[model samples]
Target chain A: MLSPLLSSSIKYYLCFMQTVIIGSGNVAYHLAKAFVLNRIPLAQIFGRNENELSKISGELNIPYSTETLQKADLYIICVSDHSVEDVSGTITTKDCLVAHTSGSLPKEILKGDYRKASFYPLQTFSKSKALDYSKIPFFIEAENEEDRKILFEIASKISDNVMESTHEKRKYIHLTAVFACNFVNHLFARAKEISDLQVIPFDYFLPLIDETVQKIHEIDPKSAQTGPAVRNDTRVLQLHEQLLQGESLEIYKTMNLSIKKMYQLP
Target chain B: MLSPLLSSSIKYYLCFMQTVIIGSGNVAYHLAKAFVLNRIPLAQIFGRNENELSKISGELNIPYSTETLQKADLYIICVSDHSVEDVSGTITTKDCLVAHTSGSLPKEILKGDYRKASFYPLQTFSKSKALDYSKIPFFIEAENEEDRKILFEIASKISDNVMESTHEKRKYIHLTAVFACNFVNHLFARAKEISDLQVIPFDYFLPLIDETVQKIHEIDPKSAQTGPAVRNDTRVLQLHEQLLQGESLEIYKTMNLSIKKMYQLP
Candidate 1:
C-alpha cells in the first residue's frame, strides 16, 4: 500500500533498458522488426559482414555494426550452424543475458558468467516475405526463474503462442518438422522434375498438393491414406516402377515399399 | 466441306450417349455433383451397398442402382481397388466403353470387349468436404482415339487441367504423392502424439504446420530447410534423442540422419 515510490522507480527502469539483436539472418531480422513494431527500441544489430548488416540496417532503419559486441540487456545470436560457436566466442558480455536463435542448440553453449537462454522461433523465414510473427510459436529456454520470465514476456509481446520447450524437445520437434516439411517438399520437387521431363506443367500438381494438405484437418493420416501401395495394386505399381527406370525409379520403389510396409500391404 | 446430313447424324448420336459413374465413394459423389452442377446429365451413380448409394442418390436426385448395371455409353467404375476387378468382370459388354477411376490401375485391367480406359482424378477426396472439381486435375487414359476423345471431353466438362497420362506415369505420380502427402501427415500425427504426451496443446503446432506449407510457395525447400540436424548442433540433437527415448526414438534417429544426409551436414 505504501509502495508508490518503488512502483514509479520500476516503471522508469523498464522504459530505459534497450533490446539488442546480435545477428542479421532471417530469424534475427524478423524478431528485430517485430520488436521495433512493438515500440521496443532495437539498440543495435551486429553482423560479421558490413554488407549483410547494411541490408538489414537499410530495411529496418536500425543502427548496424561490424564491431565487437557491447553490453546490453539481451544479446541474441542468430548466425548459421558453423558460425554459432565462433560467434558466441567473440561476444565479450560476461554479465548480460545471452541467447541463441536455434531449435537444436542447447542454451549451455552460449553460457558464460552471464545468463544463457534460447529464443527459437519455430517458423521458416524468408527475407522477401513479410512473416506473420503473431502466429509463429517462440520456444523459450532460460537458465533461471527471472530470466525465463523475462524471455517469456519478451516472446509473448511479439507472438501469441509462446512455450517453454527444452533443447531436447525442440530438437525432436525440428526433426519431425524436417520429415513433415522439407522431405515432403523434396518429393514434390521430384514430382515436378518428372512431370517437367514429360513436358507437363508444374502447376498441374498444385491442386492435388492443396487438397492433400487440407485432408489432414478432417481425418487421421493413417485412415486417410490412399494409392496403389495401400491398395496392394501390384500391377499398377510395377508399371510405375518400369516407367521410372533409374535413380528416380529406385526412389519411387523405396518410398512405395515404405508405405506398403507401413500399411501392411502385400 | 462436311456434309449437312453427316453433321445432323453426329448431333443425333451426341444427344443420346452420356457418361455414367458407377460408385458412391468420394470420387463418384464429387464427380457426379460437379457434372450435374455444370448442366451435364452424364452421372449415373451406382453402388453395391444400399446405405452408401442412397446417401448420394438422395442428395443429387440422380438414379441409384444396387443390383443391376444399366446400359450406358461410358461406365466409370469408382469402387474400391479390391472390387475393381469384380465390378469390371460383372459389367462385361462387347461394345460399351468402361473405365476405372484409379491413378495406379492400368486401363487394360477392365479386360472386357468394351474400350476400357482410366479417368483418374489426381487429388484426395473426403465425403463430408465439398471439393471444387473444376480445380482438380483429371488424368485420362484410353484404349483408342475415339475413347480418348470421349474421356477427354468428359474430363474437360468439369476441370480445366486435364492430361492424358499413361498408367505408368500415373502410378509414379501416385507413389510420389504418398511421400509428399501421406507421409507428411504421419509425421504431423507423430508430433501431435508426442506433444500430447508432454501435455502440450496440439494447437501450438498448427502455426508451424501452416507456415511450413506456405514457405514452399516462396522458395525451394532445400534452401528453406531449418532444424537441428541441418544446423548440425550435435548436443541439442542428442538431448532431443534422449527426450524421445522409446519407440519414437527410432523414428527420430532415422529422420534426423536422413535430413543430415540430404543436406550433407557435418
Candidate 2:
C-alpha cells in the first residue's frame, strides 16, 4: 500500500491517458458510447466509412476522421480481425500504446513497433441495443504491466468486471462464446423454422427460451437439463427426427446423440 | 355480440368451473402457484408424492392428498408424460373434464368416459425459481367448446398469452421446445466445460448468453447470428475444433457445419 496522496496521484495518471478508437462498427459504437457515458474523454474516432463514422460522431458528440489519425496515448483498433494489421500499420505515432479489441486475435498481431495490447469486451454488441456496461466483462492484455494497468484502469471506469488474461485463455474464451452465443442463436433459428411450418407463432417459444437461460444462472446446466435427449425418450425422439429433414434433420440427430452421450445414456 | 345480461352469466359460468391439479413435479408446483396467485380457486391438489405435496400444501394453503382426490369440474393432469395415462385413469370423478398438461402427448391418450383436453403451459419450471406466469404461453385443446372456454378463462386469469392449439400443433410445439430450451442449455453446459478448463469464471459468460437471447427478441436469430461459423473464419474454427475432444468436438463440428450450410457458406 502506498500513501494516500501518492495513490490519488497515481490514479490521476492512470485515468488521464488520452485514447482514440478506430472503427465505426457495433463494438466501436458501443465502446465509444460507454466511454462518453462514463465521462472518459476520447481524442478521436477514425474509420474508413464516412457515413457511419459521421453518424457515430453526431450521436456521441465525438470528433471523427476518415483519413488523418489522431495522436493519443492509447489507440484502440476496433476494426475487423483481417483489417486490424493494416489499420494498426497506418498509425505513425511513435512510443504510444496500441491495443486491438478482438476476441480471437492476439495482441502481437498489431503491426506496430509501439506497445501492443488487447482490450476485449466479452459480450455481443448491437448498435441499436442499450447495454448495461457495468455488467460487461473486459479482458485486458498488454506487453508490459504499466500498459496493462492503464488499460485495466480505463476499463474499470466503465465496467465492474475486469481481468488481465493471456492470449491462450482469450482464445478459449472466444471459442466458448461461439458455442454459447452463436450456436445457441442458430438453434433458435432452427426452432423458429420448425414452429413456422405449422404457423405456430414464434413468439410462443420466447418464454421457454428465456426460462432456459434463467435456469443456468442458479442451477448447473447439466443438472438443470430436461427434455427428450436427456430423458432418452425414444418415441418422442423418433417423431421429432422424422419431422425434420436435410440439415435440420442432421442437427437434430447430432444434438440428441451428443446430449445422450453427455448424460451417459445408452 | 351477445346481450350484456346473458354474457355476464356466461362469464360467471366459465370462471366458476372448479379446477383440480394432479402430480407433484415442477409443472404441478408452478401451475398451482400461478393459479393461487391469480385468485383462481383450486378444489384440491392430488398426487402420490406425499412429501412434495405437503410442502406445496404448507406453502400454498391448498388442500393436498396422496390417496383421495376431491371432485372437481376439471382435472388437469400435470404428471410425467409416462404417468399421465395412469394418473388420468385414477380420476374416478364422473362427467368432469379431464386434461393432461403435456406438450407431446395427445389428448386422446386420456382413458376415461369423461371429456379429454390438454392445458399445457409452454415453459420450463423449477421448484426454487419464481416465474412471471403471464409470459408463459398456455396451449389449450379440448374435445368440446364449453371445456375449452373454461380452460381459456382459467388460463387467461394467470397468463396474458393463451391460445387454442391442436394436438398435432402441440407436438411440434414440444419438439420446438426441445431444440430451443434443452439443446440450447446443453450448449451452455459445454461452454462452461470449456471455460472451466481455462479457469475462466463462468459468470463472465452470462452477459454474452443474455445478449444472445435478448438479440433474438428484437432481431430474427438468422440475421443476428455471429461467430466463426457465420464469419466463415476457418482458422478460428479449426482452433476451436482442436480444443474440444470426444462428444464436445463432435458437437462443435456438427454445429459449425449446420450453421455454414444454413448460411450457404463453403
Candidate 3:
C-alpha cells in the first residue's frame, strides 16, 4: 500500500514544475510577467535579442537566455509572423509541448519532431502598457488529445476565458482582428491628422468615438451606422470634400461611399 | 427703489423657471433625461412623433407637446439633417435664445429672425441607451455676441468641456468623426462577421479591441499599430487572403497593402 505522505509529496512536486517561454516580444513579456505574478515559476525566457531579453529579465526578475530551448512541460513561442517558422525550426523539443502565440499562422508551422500546440491570446499588446491577462481571452489549439488537455489546463490558470479552436478558425479570427483593431486605429490616426491640421481640438472627436463603440455593444453596427454618408446628404458631403483637399479627402470619400453602398442609402 | 417683498418673490420665480427641450430625437431625449437627473426641471418636450414625445414626457414627468414653438428662455432644435432649415423656418422668437443640435449643419441653420446659436453635442446617441452627458463634449457656436453667451451658459450647465468652433471647423470635426467612429465600427462589424462565420466566439476579439483603444490613451496610434501587415509578413498576408476569399479577401489585401505602404515596412 502507498503511504499518504508519499502521494502528497508527488502532487506537490508536479505542481512546482517550471514553465519556459520562448521568444521575447510583447506577448511573451506580458505572459511571463503574469505567470510570475501568479507565483508560477518561470524557468527560462529564450530569444535572439540580448537587449530585449535583458530588459524583460530585469523587469520580471526572471532568468534569460540567447541559447537553446530548455526542456520543460511547456514552451511558448512568441515571435513575429515571419519569425515563427524560423524560430520553430531551431527548437528540438520532441517530448515537450511547444506552442506559438499567433493569430493568423497555422499550427502546422510547428510541424517537426515535437508535440506542437498553440496558445493564442486574442489581444493587441504594447510594451508601454501593462495588460490584465485575466480579462484577455486565450485560444488553445493542439494536435492530439493529451497535448490539447495540457495546453488548456495551462491557459485556464491565467485567464478566465479559454477555449479550443482550430488553426483555420483562428486564422479567420486573426483576419477579422486586423480589420477591427489595426485598420480601425489607422482610421483614428488619419482622423486625428485631419482634425489637427484644421486646428480643431481632438477631444471633439472623442465623444463620437466613445458613442460609436458603446452603441455596438447594444445593437448591430449595420443598423447603428450614422453619418452624412448614411443619410446621403450630398450637399454636406460635397462641402466636406471641398474642405478636405488632399489624400485624406480621397480616403474619406472612399470610406463614405463604402458606408453609403453598404447601407444602400442613396 | 423696489420693495423687499416684491424683489424676493421675483428672485424665487426666476430660480424656479425650468429649461425646456424641443424635438424628441436621440439628442433631445438624452439631454432631457440628463437635465432631469441634474435636478434642472425639463418644463416641456416637443416632437412630431407623439408616441416618442409622450414616452419621454411620461418618463421624465415633464409636459408633452405636438404644438408650435412656445415662449421659453431657450429653444433647441434637435431634428434630422434636412429638417434643420424647415424646422427653424417658422420660429420668429427674436427674444428667445435659439440653437440647433447638429454637427455638420452650421449654427446659421437656425438663423431665423431670432437670436441664433448651436448646442451641438459631439457624440452619437441611440434612443435605447442612456448616455452620460457629462462625459460628452459640447460644441457651441453663435452668429452674434449675446446669443453666444447664452448658448455657452446653457451648454455649461451640462458639460464641462465646451468650445467655440466655426462652421468650417465643426464640419471638419464631423468628417473626422466619421472615420474614427462610423468607419471604425464598420470594420468591427466586418471582423465580427468573419469571426462568426469561422465559428469562433466573438468574445475572442474583444480583448484585442479593448487593448487597441486603451493603447491610444498612452501612445500615438502610428506607433501603436501592429499585426502581419505592419510587420510586412507577406507569408501570413498571403495565407490570410487565402482564408478570407472574395470581396473580404480584396478588402483585406487592399488594407494590408495600404498599411504596408504607409509604414514603408518592406
User: Highest lDDT among the candidates is held by which one?
Assistant: 2
Q: Give the alpha carbon lDDT tens digit for every residue of A150-262 in model 2.
A: 78778999999999898999998998998899889999998998988889889899999999999889999888888878878888888887788987788888888888988
Per-candidate DockQ vs. reference: 0.38, 0.76, 0.60
Pick out the ten consecutive residues of candidate 2 chain A with the lowest summed lDDT.
A1-10
Name model 1 segments beyond 4 Å from true: A1-14, A81-86, A144-146, A234-266, B1-16, B93-95, B143-146, B228-266
Per-residue alpha-carbon lDDT of model 1 for B121-197, expressed as tens digits? 87877787778889988989887766776677678878988888888677766665655565565556556667666
Worst 10 residues of 3 chain A by lDDT: A1-10
Best-to-worst order by TM-score is 2, 3, 1
Q: Largest DockQ belongs to which candidate?
A: 2
> In DockQ, how does model 1 score against the reference complex?
0.38
Q: What is the descending lDDT order?
A: 2, 3, 1
- For each candidate, the alpha-carbon lDDT, in order, equals 0.72, 0.88, 0.76
Q: What TM-score number comes out for model 1?
A: 0.85
Lowest-lDDT window of 10 residues in candidate 3 chain B? B6-15
Give the chain B TM-score for each candidate.
0.89, 0.96, 0.87
Evaluated on chain A only, model 3 obtains a TM-score of 0.90
